[model samples]
Target: MNRYQVATAELASSQKSGAGVPAYLRWVNRGLGRRAAAVAYVAGLSPNAVTLISGMLSVGGMVVLVFLPMSALSAVAAMVLFLAGYALDSADGQLARLTNRGSIAGEWLDHVVDSLRLPLVHLAIALCLWRAGLPDWSVVVALLFLVLSSSWFFAQTLAGKLSAKAADDGSAAEGTPDWVSFAKIPYDVGTLYVVVAALAYPPLFLVLYTGLFVVTAAVAAASLRRKYRALLAEQRDYAPEN
Candidate 1:
């Protein structure tokens, strides 16, 4: 098979095996991903196009966050837009599957957009908290988790970018990898917690911090552990014979 097929197979296999996604996450991902797949097939949008749509939906969610309280209505709107963004996130891959339009460039765009959303959203949340004169600790903790999560994402993205570059240049790639060997951790944990957060507190904003931070920490730990073992395996030289 060609590189495109090879890459796609790797991803699809990783997904099917739940190699790096938390088991509990499968509950939401199964449904959202399937729905995204359906929309992608019907809409004929490319993965990059889907990524752009996801970013736009997220910004729209941010707009709502700024204008409204963390009330039931606002929570619902934010949840809708957030899910829309996530649907787009899932759709990108599904579109690639349907149209055979997947590419390193498409993957690159998806990761870039996904990475940006967390920081920007956290900044928006912090701003809202400041505006409402809530205790500084919540926003501070959220931002801290956001930073940790962002750093982990950058590491993963850089790994992918390097892998793409290496494939372009015909060499080995660098940077931390996309998964922790066999341990699955869902990259979309923020959206995963949205419903739970909304349900758990009087205001949706209240639960966002603990939920995101704890999950981020778990994913990061899993990621680092995987990278360590993968490195060891990679370093062991395999001498081929005739």
Candidate 2:
């Protein structure tokens, strides 16, 4: 294979099968990520370099939203930057795999970018809405939404830890629901689209936001329960005689 094909194939090998992506958006993101990875690989860019650019663009987009006055044109620009950042986020992992230089540090840094970007986007939007002179209650809603969404990430971390313990004990915890992951796309990879759509129609966006929040909140609770239950089961397996 040529370099481009080689790079794309490497990405395919390393990539998950749309783990958290909605069905409709999966193909688009996959194509964008692979293409970007190919281009970055051909350009001899390191994975960390791609990651740094992604972080800068994503964070800078939020900075625009929170610090500047809201406007349709500005919102569109922010969405473009955020989407580019996300596409590059995908490319970084693929590039890492292609270079055989994937490391724990790179993984942690990628996640750190995501961890910050997710909550900050919500906070930025909340502040933007406040600056737009929306009610104080709307800002409160935004903050609450941010808290619930960030909690979901913490729940996933807990689940990962419990899964590791369960695996060590040879107890297979139940498989995670695909739809739960799909439902979270609006809050993650799909955030730019969500924000753009919301910016176009504020009242409708509130309803949709509430719906997403409810679904994700439910999924987080379910995930946490499963993880905690598995942890208890592991304890029981190792428990001493009464």
Candidate 3:
């Protein structure tokens, strides 16, 4: 459709806000992403285009992590690419909401890309560390980190779906304060910023990544366990009486 038609379509679902976003990413998603979404809308670009671009950036960043020197400059370049990719990731969804043009297929593709990237990125980092002559232990730690990270992401997705299914009004949970957002930064997907920064110094990167992996594994495990129990209790409480 033309720009005017796109603008009109956008107005149909034009709230353009995100829920439960961390403060660190709030600026990227709400600020930069929104600006990009506006331009995309005017340019008549579909959300799918934005999604594909995001995927490309992410894939390129992973490639760099795997193949390039683990130098500061390389880390910076890869980090910039990742940041742009993530911003576009947010923008695609925003654009979809704005234009009321979201589709199940689009959402599925977005999540699929995300699921692919999360573990692969870590594995790439591990490979980079090994190439940098880091200890074998670090490589093992990185592999373990990949498994935990992917499991955590999948668990959170499942929890979100279950929560949505259980909510009677179909409304999202209430938003938390900015401090809570800050507290969550370590666990956020955008924590890759921290990852890339750490990579610039391989020794520090190993420690930071290992620490994050341990902490994240604990947090994800607890959250998933609690959510699972709650879901079980709900099912039992609502089970049909004989």
- Top candidate (lDDT): 3
Q: How well does candidate 1 match the true structure in TM-score terms? A: 0.69
Error of 2 at 120 (Å): 0.7
Full ranking by lDDT:
3, 2, 1
Tens-place lDDT digits, model 1, residues 20-103: 344434445544665665555556556787789889998887777677766667767776787778767776776676567889
Best by TM-score: 3
- lDDT, candidates in the order shown: 0.62, 0.71, 0.75
Please write out the lDDT profile of model 3 over residues 138-192, one tens digit for every residue: 9998888789878877876776676644222211236645566676667677775
Q: Report clashes for each candidate as comma-separated counts.
A: 4, 0, 0
- Residue 7, model 3, lDDT: 52
Whole-model alpha-carbon lDDT for candidate 2: 0.71
Candidate 3 — what's its lDDT? 0.75
RMSD of each: 8.7, 4.5, 4.3
Clashing pairs in 3: none
Model 2, residue 61: what's the lDDT?
80
Candidate 1: stretches off by over 4 Å: 1-15, 23-25, 159-208, 218-222, 225-242
130-209 per-residue lDDT for model 2 (tens digits):
88787787778778878976776766665565567532322222454567555556545465444544654566666766
Q: Where is the poorest 10-residue window by lDDT in model 3?
A: 164-173
Model 2 residue runs over 4 Å out of place are: 19-21, 165-188, 191-193, 237-242
